[model samples]
Target: MERTRRSTIRSLAALGAAGLAGCLDGGLVGSVRERGGDGDESDESGDGDAPDEGRGPPTADGSRHLAYDLETLREESLSGGVGTDGIPSVENPTFVRIDEPTLIDDVPVFGVARGGEAKAYPQYVLVHHEIVNDVVGGDPVAVTYCPLTGTAQGFERGGTTFGVSGQLVNSNLIMYDRATGSWWPQMLATGIDGPMRGGTLREFRVVWTTLGEWRAAHPDSLIMTDETGYARRYENDPYGLYAPLGGYYADEETLFPPLSDPEEGHPKSVVVGARTADGAVAFDKASLLVERVLSGTLRPSDEPVIAVADPALSTGYVYLNPKNVTVEPDGDGYRVGGDGVGGAAESEGAVDADDLPLERVLAFDAMWFAWAGFYPETGFVGDHTGAGYGR
Candidate 1:
């Protein structure tokens, strides 16, 4: 996975009908070790204070807000003309490539879909994996991916401070084909759920290099979102019924902590979701909390939203969401490609409570990918590593 800082947000609006569990307090076996506790059978004790036991709302210091410039992050990767292959093309696209295509288990990865198409998920769409540990304050959160509501503009603290939470997840910016307005979703699941069917893969279209430019042009386009009413929303999903699609997982200690004050006494960055000695996987609780936003319980108006920042090159330590992204003079932030996304603009659409196709959409995640992975004749796993991975 591409290395970046760890940052995050908190919400549970995607669970729909699943009743918010109140503050995500279920402690994980990993959190305990990070807090100077035990990571083994001790977690089985079910102590209310366990890291896997979930946490309460954040405090004043724990909340944050974020904003960025637009032009700075906008780099047009596409030529000034349409593709020679007759496929759609966006102005100055910033395509994300997935290297080394093959079967993670058995599923064919192919390539990924850009932005703007029905069903955010497409065959071979690369995935981003982010593990959250700490936020602005000494709080914890988790990093999760969903394609339903689209990425939140940013996180907030104390109800007003907004923080950036896009880069690390890589699901924030979405692509839109200037030719066809069809919106294609990226595939989050890697393992072969089953064979690709006819219409199942038709919703996606291939676009040339320009993933970044497309996002810059259509600021309204959403990349990923959080879950708001997942339990009930996915209860009837065909994927969920046949093979469970979206859900939560708790791992070992957080490699990164998304610290509010990186310069202060903070933990160093580690590979996200990496396993430590003793066979335990490193992770963060803050990431899980942010993911709960898809639980149908979090609302857009919720106060003190939590978030993390993606460190440069998987340093592992997570920073507070607003703390990580340093917007440039133009109000935009910088990533590897110097592409920055402005604050999220409100999308004009009514939630289709009953029309969910993939279980992740119900959780509000955005999707995007490079054109190399969109070919109908291509197999899973091409030249990109983003496929089958999670952000």
Candidate 2:
């Protein structure tokens, strides 16, 4: 997919670890609290289900309010799983799936999709919470994630380069990060209906195959990250069809993290810059150089935090999953609309699939409110900060 020259540039400018340190620090502490909370109340214990210890006070149900489990959400086909009829209603009604292991540029990655018809989520393009909470129908949908590469699968959908935060939120096909155990749920707001419409065949597997091929080739790409950081730069891509109507920047760049042993702790010393076409350039004339990592150009390092290429996912109109129907062949094609959150959210004024602009989309305030109440841990952190947080 051709990235909007402007948005691409903005993405580079937006790259920084300022808030990242805070987010990551808070995220880790939050993970421990939430996960620990689960063992005390619930029986299931896994990364996806790991409770947010740092969030809100425990609900009566004791669920940490997380989207999905990272460790336990094994890849499974929806051939005969239970339908959405029995699933309880959730504020953020995200769909979860574990897919077959596929090679990308010889690197293996897992599949994880979240959200539905009302939103579109791009993996790595817009890095915010490890979990994604989007609106589907009118309900809140949270998606838990873990990804091998920092980012993966740069693709086009509906003629737009969907490298934005919420473009594929409701699309069927989603991707996962193998290393981090992250799941990326995708859906298109332009078509289909609600969460009940979610099925394995049409929505899930289609994207799996597309990203598998891309991962088999491109391995050294940079996924999107938080644009609210100090050392970051975010541009607007005018030609970015997926970007909000106003357009975005291009020729984005950022200083890469210095290489170091995990035990030694990486220093914020080195400076690296990555461009859409020219590729990555390091200030240090010659360190270990890699090209098109996502495209699978070089030998992967033992180092966990290595830069890789973006998985090239396909673009075009994606069909929404039909709701409350048996999984069988239908000559008339799949039906659209159902009781899923996508439909409900659309009915309300929270968000509009057809009209959300890129500028608004890129604005942190606009997107943050969408899932402000995600994991209980986030609530806990906010409270802690309000009470006087420690560095």
Candidate 3:
């Protein structure tokens, strides 16, 4: 597959003294040196601090892992081209209202909204700068995108900041925190190395959708501008066109092997997964497209979970099914209220008829192989069956 071929080429290109000289001229090695550092001087951890002690293997509840072991995580992955701060993060980024004639309608963007504040981060911009440290809804948030994994997520960083660690585990971007100098895998959201090892990050929902759909949902939303301090081609996508899902993203193979074997589903199939205190569940995107709404009970606790697919955004949200409300496709939005409240409009305001709002559980979208590799025993809620790891 194209993905494997790309990986082989990159691996071969990183070998030998001639390859080292070539890299020095310009390539992955040079890029890593240019970007690999303690980030800004202000954020540097010059003080001597020992790395965190290693822990036991990941739990069997599909919550954790022992992949490559924490001690060897840094050395296990490719290093030359993966440069820290190589893709400079946009600090205190500027945004314009959605009605402004800056961005086209069809361009793909990651949309996030909270406390009435909404913003869009374009894929073209994120493809270069994978991390954006910005404040939203009076909270410090980091908007991150991994082109290789096709994962876009929002993380609450408290008062600290995050930078690209110039590393990849399972072909996914690894991030480092400025305060603790700890390494965090983007999808896992846990610290694997340094002072903050075993710590978890608070995540927020980021809708992966086109600009047109986001604008319709949030007319008053703000869009990121090209006023970024760095100079580069904003119109050009280094990973290929994503609006139609072509290029590297469309391939069914991965650039690097994952720590755990991928046993179920296609390598590139998209799935919306949610993890609770008990276990994790993954809803197939293809199945969601057909059913619109899927309801199931998570393992170990039998806690009810609901997945509602939004075709307009090309994303799905997983929420705890506490109210037991049946969801159906209603015009542009969804009628999530009780049975009697048929086709109720969100503006009509009948969502609170039961005196309880739908509690949203944290969830994010990932490729099937990445998801299965991380949570091998995860339950599936669509056409695919649950096949435990190393099948």
Best by TM-score: 3
lDDT of 3 by residue, 4-71 (tens): 32344465442210000000011111011111112110111223222222421111111222223344
Q: Pick the candidate with the highest lDDT.
A: 3
Candidate 2 local lDDT, 330-387, one digit each (tens)? 1212122225433312122222221211110100001111122112111100111110
Model 3 poorest ten-residue lDDT run: 17-26
- List the candidate 3 regions with Cα displacement exceeding 4 Å: 1-80, 297-302, 322-358, 383-391
> What TM-score number comes out for model 1?
0.18
Error of 2 at 377 (Å): 23
Local distance difference test values of all predictions, in order = 0.18, 0.20, 0.61
For model 2 the local lDDT of residue 173 reads 23
**lDDT of candidate 1 over 154-191, digit per residue (tens):** 11111111111222111222222112221112221110
Candidate 1 at 248: error in angstroms? Answer: 24
Q: Which ten-residue region of model 1 has the weakest summed lDDT?
A: 61-70
**2 or 3: which has the higher lDDT?**
3
TM-score of 2: 0.20
Model 2: ten consecutive residues of lowest lDDT: 358-367
After aligning candidate 2 to the native by TM-score, how far in Å is the CA of 241 from where it should be?
20
Every model's TM-score: 0.18, 0.20, 0.73
